[model samples]
Target: MKRQFAVIGLGRFGGSVCCALIEQGMEVLAIDQDEARVNKYRDLVTHAVVADATDEQALKHLGIRNFEHVIIAIGDNIQASILTTLILDELGVEHITVKAQNDYHEKVLTKIGAERIVHPERDMGVRLAHHLLSKNVLDYLELSDKHSIIEIIASTKMSGKTLMKLDVRAKFGCNVMAIKRGREIIVSPQATQLIKEEDILIVIGADEDIKRFEHEMFDE
Candidate 1:
């Protein structure tokens, strides 16, 4: 069976989620209060409807709880967003992801049982800043507030060194999850595996430890 996903609000973020989910061959229901927005996506998604999400009866009528995952992407209308999330929570939705407009919104959503809260603008900025901060840092993915997984291009200075020789766990407190060389990727790369220049290393650890590793390894 295909996974069911519902996205509320037809803003940029919500619309993007619908498109991406549909691209992945999943069933997506696009919901928005604006009839135009709903009609625009009618042909693109599995289902599209215009309804006031804050209305509990409306959500119930649509069987919102049946969706495996629901995303509350109402922009600007913080009150409506909170109310929608509350209704989803009350209905015992399996998973709820909400887009937060600010820190206060995120706090309120957390208190009301939102399973996931994303600050896309702020998160993308942080990831971009980290990429600009180091020559080796290719990408950054936040695992949590304090932890992250980073993809780093190994430099010549660290080439020819095996994982055991580098002692990343002991020295930098990060674990190498995988190493991508050309077209092949080594998952859970062995400690005996040597890192060559240009190899992409995927590592995960506390954010502070990751920063220390970057500074010590390439800050020169």
Candidate 2:
């Protein structure tokens, strides 16, 4: 069965989520107070409606509680975001994801029982900064506040060495979860897996451990 999702506020982030969810074959209901925004996505999504999500009666009329997941991506307007989230919670929406404009907004959303809160702009900035931090650091994914998964392009120093020889886990506490070589990807690479120059390593560990591994392997 296809999952059902409702995205409130058809701004940039909400619109992107709607598009992505549609691409994944999920049934999405797009909502916004702006008629133009609703009309823009009317044909693209499963359903699009211009309604004030802050209105409890409006939400009930739309049967918002029926969706398995709902994302409140209201932009800039913290009060409306909070009110919508509160209403969704009271209406028994099982999973609620909210986009927060700032730390204060995030705190209020958390208190109102939002299951997930995201800072898209801040997160993208962090990812971009990590990409710029090192030439070898190709990508960074935050798993938590302290842990991350990073994709690093192997250097000449790591060439001709096996995972066992590198002893990365013992020395740096980071795990090389996979090795992407050209067109092939080796998931859960063995300890004896050979490391080749330019092979992309998917490493995961605590932030500090990842930093230590990067410095020793790439910086030095």
Cα lDDT, all candidates: 0.93, 0.96
User: lDDT by residue for model 2 over 109-219, one digit each (tens)?
Assistant: 999899999999998999899999899988899999999999999988899999999999999999999999999999999999999999999999999999999888898
Error of 1 at 18 (Å): 0.9
Runs in model 1 deviating more than 4 A are none
Question: Which candidate number has the best TM-score?
Answer: 2
> For model 1, how does the per-residue alpha-carbon lDDT over 95-175 read when each residue is reduced to its tens digit?
999999999999999999899999988889988998887878899999888999999998776799999998999998999
Q: What TM value does model 1 have?
A: 0.96
- What are the models' TM-scores? 0.96, 0.97
Clashing pairs in 1: none
Q: Once model 2 is optimally superposed onto the true structure by TM-score, how far is the C-alpha of residue 150 displaced, in angstroms?
A: 0.9
Q: Which one wins on lDDT?
A: 2
